[model samples]
Target: MRGCLLDAGYTPDGVRALLGRSAHDALTRGEPEPAARASRDGDELGTLVRLFLLEDTEPEPAVTAALGDLDPLLAGRILRRTPEGIRAALDVRPYGEGPGDDGEPGADWWVVSDLDSPASRQDREHVTGVGGASLSLAAATVRRPVGSLLDLGTGCGVQALHGSRHAVNVVATDVLPRALALARLSCGLSGVDVDLREGPWFAPVEGERFDQIVSNPPFVPGPERVDYVYRDSGLAGDAALASLLGGLADRLNPGGIAQLLGSWLHVRGEDWPDRVRSWLPDGVDAWVLQREVVDPAMHVGTWQRDAGLVPSSPAARGQAAAWLDWMAAERVEGVGFGFLMLRRTDSTPTVVVEDLPGELGEGLAREMTGWLDRIDWLRAHERDADLLGATLLIAPETVLESASSVDPDGGWSELSTTVRRWGGPGWEHPVDGPAAALLAGCRGHLPLSELVALLSYAHDVPADALVAAALPAVREFVRHGLLLPVDGWPHPVAHRVAAADPAGPVG
Candidate 1:
């Protein structure tokens, strides 16, 4: 059956192409699977699509032929013989493997979840299959080899399935029994083993520590109660997210990393960074990248739309108004959605808050881990004397660009210089003459002190004075990942420079 689905073009890109762009867009928006049956009616692919995706009844023979069996499916409640024809008991769709997941290319696994909003009977206990948030969290996870991983709120066990590639053991937890049951089926079908447990966050794994933890929890910020278990906790706005983050320190081993997707309230008159920072424990380094923010009105509307409620509906206006009023009463300025990467480090913790509205690309896990390692190096070597002896190299993705002013006398004068990075944080740093020279010359061949000494000789300046003038830029470059140690440079230094201005170094 899996082979049949793959051969019939049911993969992620394949389904989009088969449905055409517009219909694909509609399906993602919780609309019915439009044009699927119209385009491939009465065929094997169409029969499978109708039965699983569209939630439409098909002739008993067609479904049986596509599945190759009826007794097993019926016994499992995956298929039911209705008076009209054959109906699907669950939503089993083809989930494409992510870039770094432990699976072969072009592999598709059957993800089992409760029927979605469009096809659902408005059940509050919907266990989502592969949705946008699930995919986003999967992409953002730092995939390192680990002894164990905890997939908190593992609705369909997608994160556990992804983590099982590198982890020796994966423990998946869910609050809802149905979710855990379906997740077990999902893992079984994918040929993955998971320790499935039923409980609220952190309870099932009490007193347990993991090398990594991941979650795409019910983070939608709303009133104290909501019907949907998959997208909302009974707690008030953003508390679910805060609670999850607050519990990280106890659950993580030293140097363990946790990545999760969440929505937090942007309260009025409060610094959002500080708000998020308060949730982090004292021993963890964190990077909270805010991807999107929506006003209170828009936030409520988004959730309503996900529940298939439109503003035009009579009840929706009151619900929207009530939600907005409640948010205002709670002093919510806005709602922010993002990914949080937390690592339990023994050193003084560092928290970086930034905005990244762009879509995440592949290899983020490796990149995130590398960025954290660089931060460790920066904190450890904060002195010029310690940095001066280190061999430095410009990062590969860095590019140097300059602009000059044409003087009134027709002479060119350099105006400004900048170094742009492409691969990691995508930061562009302004550079001066000394910094530009450092980038051009520091190709991992010589120590920074030697490189500065050569520059001093070329410019007819004393080596000590040149080193003093260049220390600031050197520190800035290293902090931003533009400069790096080439060989053994981690030894303690006897002398230290007081400070380094990141603006640029004077030479």
Candidate 2:
């Protein structure tokens, strides 16, 4: 049945194409899905759409034909047959990235969760279907093949589905029994085998470790109270997130990586970086990207609306006030949401916390992998002599921008130059004329020392002073991926091509 649906153009993109533009927009905006017209049309795909995708009742014959060998008991549990028609008790939709026009591979998984939004009856234990956060984590997931993987708080097992494609075996867990059931159904529907467990966080995998761990945990710094099992953690403030991070060390194998999405409370007069950094276990390489920060009032309203609270109503206003009061009492300044990637290692660990763009770009995982390698290489060659002797290449995505102000004479008065990386963990750095010339000349063919010597002679500056002035900017360039090591060994050895790409886009 799943394959048949795919054959008949049942996909995320297909759904949008079939529903027209306005209906597609309405569905994404959380308005009631525009399904009345499609449901009444009664085409084969439309019949299935009404019965399953739209969470609406369908004729008995349509239900029978859509699911050829569906178990009667399971069907009964999924739908309630009546004199007029059989109404669906569950929601099933085509889910995948969808194939690109230029022949790119897309997701083809069919996800099953409780009926959401307009179809929801406000079940406190409701398992959530696919949403923005879920897709964000999925796109951000690193897809290196692994022997074992763990999906904590695996709501509908979407992460597990993605994991199964790269991992030999996947273990997914959720505290809510209903969530585990739904995850099982979703994995089964997608024909991906997953070990579904009922436990919170790392409880089920207490002593076990995995090669990779991925989670889209319930990290909402809450109203301090909420009914949704899939969103609320029942813990005060960000304790749930704290616990999840603190325990990551024991759950990962050596060199194992964990990618997670979470929300942390940012209190007044406290450094957010210090608070988040304290959660890390010793000897772990960590990168924390603070994606967005929402203040108390806005955060409350957003979650309230998600919980079906209407903003203009007096009740909603009261709830919002109470939420603000709670945040105030807790000293919460804002709620920071973002992604964390942790690697367990015995070597000296590095921690980086910075604000990055909200959207995950293409090749982010590969970019991250490259970054870790770059960090390791930089850490090994920190001294001036070690760095100066090595050859450097401008990053492919790097572009040099310059602005000049005219003097009274109209010749070039002053020139300010900046080097910006065009893609792959984008970054920009200001550079002086000498530094810019040096970067432009160090194109993997010549050593940095030779370039610095030539520049010092041309500019009539001492070579030592020139290298000293350029050191800080050069370090920043390498650290931020603007400059890459290409060739010429620091030690007495043959010239070697470094690990980074040397001939990327020059600009």
Candidate 3:
């Protein structure tokens, strides 16, 4: 590799001149030969050599063009010149491999081979810092208007790097010092200054609260260890993630939001959402989106394979034993995966629980924004529109007060449909099961969105899924007068208010 650099018309000083100061120092410190380094299994030196010794790079002219003339954070090079090429470079481990096709074939040049030789980028085997969760949580953050931010268990510093752009001051914590060192280099290269600390959750940030806290903590509950320790936060059950949620209320600024991506053990015959709901601290308004569920066997099979535990390491045998033990001990049938959006306040608790039926990254931004908007709607709106709309639009078919009386305190009661055979003296029968339960309630009274929400809750399905599955039925119900649709929902009062305040919050 050294000779190659020299042959590529590059010398130590030339390489140093190419990169700024800090990067030069980082690179020149000590590196191994690419072949010798790649040969070693445990030594991290090989990984560094592979990442830093990039000579053939696909030019990012399009990316540069898209970035368009933004002034560089650093005038020329970030650091001073050195004998080595670059110091403290912001490197990407990728930890993944596959057909590198992402529209811009140009980007593939940046990733010639699978950079994530250690693990795949889409590696979802470990618990806390999985690919989708980490990147999504980092991406979903509303970067503007945050004063300070904290990232707990900031594996690879992806969260810290993202936060560094939006936050005035950012602090990242991890139990592993090596991870912190890696994160420091990453932040240095990204030109994002962050205070790096080493400690467990709350230990590092004691007596300190931020406007925002985002975590993709170790969330898996099983006992199997993987090559990368970055993903595992050691709690037996969902205890690690649950405790984080229960404890974060007091650690956040008033009206501050803390977004998390995690997994929870799904005990058979138990309501997963209800179990998870018990974890949120009071005075913290929360929106829970349950995206995916993996049964015990599938979970083990998938994670174990990704870790090279099975075919390579006899992971099949070891994982089978460990997972069986965990399942037997915890009586856990599966693991539920999702995202949590929470805000701490002094007011009464407001919880919105919905099945997301997907991965943490899918439509996560829209879901989070909708959650924030719903919180605003809840705080401002008083009388339930369902009741009003029922009375006015579907008066004959709607049981105006009966629906209201069904649940004295209801957040959003779903419409239940019970098929009618001609005319019966009393309501013929009540429906059952997920499908029956969700389809029974419309009675033509509520707005389509609210009705969809009700069905989504009842079926334990996603909002989008609920709409997709039930909209046709809903249109049928409307045609038959069993369901009613109202347009004046969500209060166009905002639109009117914005008439004068033209470039208002709403677009």
Candidate 4:
């Protein structure tokens, strides 16, 4: 492979810079190249290269000619670019010099996307990169300091770059050499130290555990992927994702967690949450924040275009129709997409499997890690201690005041509608009345028990009776957001739905 890379104009110095001594040793050892006998499932480079050969639909001549330029010593990768410059690299790439700003090692190479307009060969969908899924997942990552980090399916290396800022060491892996190069470039640009490895999910780092792991894996099942091919696993609905999730618990260290972004296929009559839940490993705390679901029609349209299938061409027009047919035939209700944050631990983790694409996911991801940091048994209850202590102060503008007098005749007076707050006054009931009498006594100063006792005593009633009577007012206060519990109380139904997705609207 190195010889092939050299033929492609890569240099030995380039190879040494990224692979280091171990990689060189593997390439030089008399032992069968781990990349050869190893399949896509292997942690060795053999598996990564095998996956490349298996997955590539590229013509043999192009691949063979590309490989002819062998330079085991130099960094080399193959990238296919559109005449317009838009490139989506396919091979495991070699590194070049680091970005001038810092001495960080250079990137592995490949072209998954070229600057060519979206109109170039096939999928007409807009191309997205670190700016979208990668960045979103990065922003949602747990900030706790960790000793080492793993970026599975590192792609352009965005997740690895994010991890570099926190972890002492970073391992970024991918099946594509081109992707490795791009990741290297990204690391170079960020001036971060990252060890680039070419292998599938836990492979290259076999037997190694990290305090943190983050991935924006190629979870977009074969169906709804971007035409970039680089982004999709090219596997059916959830196979790839299952492999990732099913395999994660073993890779994570105890107390360590992995944060990921992914796309899932929801089958009819099959509970999507349950399907995802089935993938969680025992004792691994998990949170699956489903952000959106696109119906068959939308999914088909979205993915066909992504594959560069032009709706205008007769062939593309048929392709689009076929996609729609396939989805409907499968009764594909929608494609579920979300972020999964998992931690390996002894405690039963609260797994929030939801269908949310709106503000809820953003808010949940932002706060959940902190919530996880503080809670012991997330699965045991939805209630958190912090929530139990939380206070909800009513806004001044929304607070209502009261002025009332009981009818002297002991008859109900006309119920008038008027909103008022406390006038500039002291501890008076504001207007002597049962409601006011009860309200004025509630000074955050009194313990609930004591306050109830006071109310009972003032009313000359049994404490139990007083509590029963005062409950309505308390309920009203809750309605007005005047008070709130700080405890993270468990919800009877563990699953909660998230907001609507902005793009793939679900019924």
Write candidate 1's Cα lDDT for 1-507 as tens digits. 555556666555566556776776676665764656444653676677667778888899887677776888799887889899998888777665544333324334667887764536246887877766877777667766789999999998778877776689999999999899989888887678899999998999999999999999899988898668888888998888888898998999999999999888888899998888888878899988888998887888878877767676888898888888889899998999988999998888878887763345552554466567667776766677777767777777778888899988898988888987766466667877766786889887788888888888877788888887788767667655676656544421221111111110000
**C-alpha lDDT (0 to 100) for residue 469 of candidate 2:** 94
Query: Which runs in model 1 stand beyond 4 Å of their true positions?
Result: 1-43, 98-107, 119-122, 357-359, 379-383, 401-417, 423-425, 454-480, 488-507
Can you write out model 2's per-residue Cα lDDT over 1-507, one digit (the tens) per residue?
666566555556666667777865665564545755743553566666767666666777776666655466255466677778877677776675433223435556778777765327256787877777777777666766699999999988888887876789999999999888888878876788999999877889989999999999888886657567888888888888888899998999999999999899999889999999999888799989888998888898888677666877897798778778889998998999988999998878878888874245553555566556667777677778888888888776788988888888878866677888775455767787788888889677888889999999988999989988998788778767777777422321232222111110000
Q: TM-scores for all candidates? A: 0.82, 0.85, 0.56, 0.56
RMSD of each: 8.1, 6.0, 15.2, 16.2
Between prediction 1 and prediction 2, the one with superior TM-score is 2
Which 10-residue window of candidate 3 scores lowest in summed lDDT? 498-507
Which 10 consecutive positions of candidate 1 have the poorest summed lDDT? 498-507
Task: Report backbone clashes per prediction.
Answer: 0, 4, 29, 71
Q: lDDT tens string, model 4, 1-507?
A: 444444443333533333345544564442324324332232223222332322323333344454533232123333443444212243233322222112234333321222222453343322334335654675577755689899887777756765665578889888777567666655653457799999766889999888888887766554544445456676666778887888888887888988888877788899888988988878787777777787766766675565556668797677677667767777777887888888888865556575442253333332455446434422332333322223223223323354346788996564442223222111111222444455454444444456556666776779776655545444434322232223333321232222111110000
Global fold similarity of model 4 (TM-score) = 0.56
Give the number of colliding residue pairs in candidate 1.
0
Q: Candidate 3 residues 1-507, lDDT tens each?
A: 222223332322333334445544453342324333232341222223233343212123321232223234123221122354223122332221111112211100010112232344334322222254554564455544489999988866767766655578889998877567666655654456789999888898899888999888777767644444555565567777888898898889998889888888889788888999998888888878676788888776776655545433664676577767878778888888877888987767678666653233223443354346544543443234332232113314323221222455856565553543222111122333543443444343445466557766766788776656654443333333333233423422221110000010000
lDDT at residue 280 of model 2 (Cα atoms):
88
Candidate number that wins on lDDT, 2 or 4:
2
Instruction: Estimate the TM-score for candidate 3.
Output: 0.56
Clashes of 2: 4
lDDT, candidates in the order shown: 0.75, 0.75, 0.53, 0.54
